[model samples]
Target: MRGSPPLPREFRLVPGRTFVDASVLVRLFDDDEPVRQAAARALVGDLNGPALVVSGPVLAEFAETVMVRLARPLAPVAVRRALTELSELTVVSADASLVLAAADTAEEEELGLRDALTLEAAVLGGCDRLATEAMRHGTVLRGIHVEDPAFGGNE
Candidate 1:
């Protein structure tokens, strides 16, 4: 699952906003993985850059994982703060076009629906980079550079 589909031709990392994946957000509060937590902090701490882009589904997934699926669920107050903080990012809502694009991505890239959805969301958000641990550390998907900020590959 870490392997990425081939990059599109004429790929370049543009100086645009980053699209964050739920995997990265979940690590922000993951105490078990101190290394990843620090990495997530370092990546998200900088607000000076262009606003990070996220999607409604990504935020919901992050919230649900932290609140219900984690080994130690965060308190209600912590979840609220996390949601509030994430809300500051540019959130893209999924629509029919996005879903259709995701379907094509899934078929073409041989990716699962959710992963394809995330990638398509990033593309729709007009992002140049995707900060995530779910996919390959340094790979281009639909012109967006994927980076695993926690694992130390592409920045």
Candidate 2:
């Protein structure tokens, strides 16, 4: 019998490091898109140990996108289960400070509202790296580093 296969490099989940963005989470269930597939694979491969961090805004966005854009409606029971799983991961609440920071980043970096929110969440969570494929390289939003695992570069 074969032993369990090795995990992906991106899924290591290093403790006290690396903040996860909604893009990565959305991909896990989005098989129709190529980018999503890559993101899902990376997370499953390298992020088994570290705490996956997200914000209230991220969760809301995920729910809306999955239900509306994807036209995939999850039952209320399933939604609750998903929330429970997300709670086990690191979820940062959106306080006044976080909102202000996100707003500022959005203005300075010209990022969309959702992207700005994600950036703020990553910073508030003390994440050294923000994993995403949404933004381009060298895109600095209040000093929070945006990284794309699939592309293997920092934004």
Q: Whose TM-score is greatest here?
A: 1
Scored by CA lDDT, what does every candidate get?
Answer: 0.81, 0.66
TM-score, candidate number 2: 0.74
lDDT of 2 by residue, 1-155 (tens): 21223334553434346667666666666767777567656764665434567778778776666666664666667666766777677777887766776777777778887788787677667666777778774455555566776766442
Give the per-residue lDDT of model 1 (tens digit) for 93-112.
Answer: 88877777788888888888
Candidate 1 positional error at 73, Å: 0.7
Q: Can you tell me which runs of candidate 2 are displaced by over 4 Å? A: 1-16, 137-140, 153-155
Pick the lDDT winner.
1
TM-scores, each model vs. reference? 0.85, 0.74
Colliding pairs, model 1:
none
Q: State the weakest 10-residue window (summed lDDT) of model 2.
A: 1-10
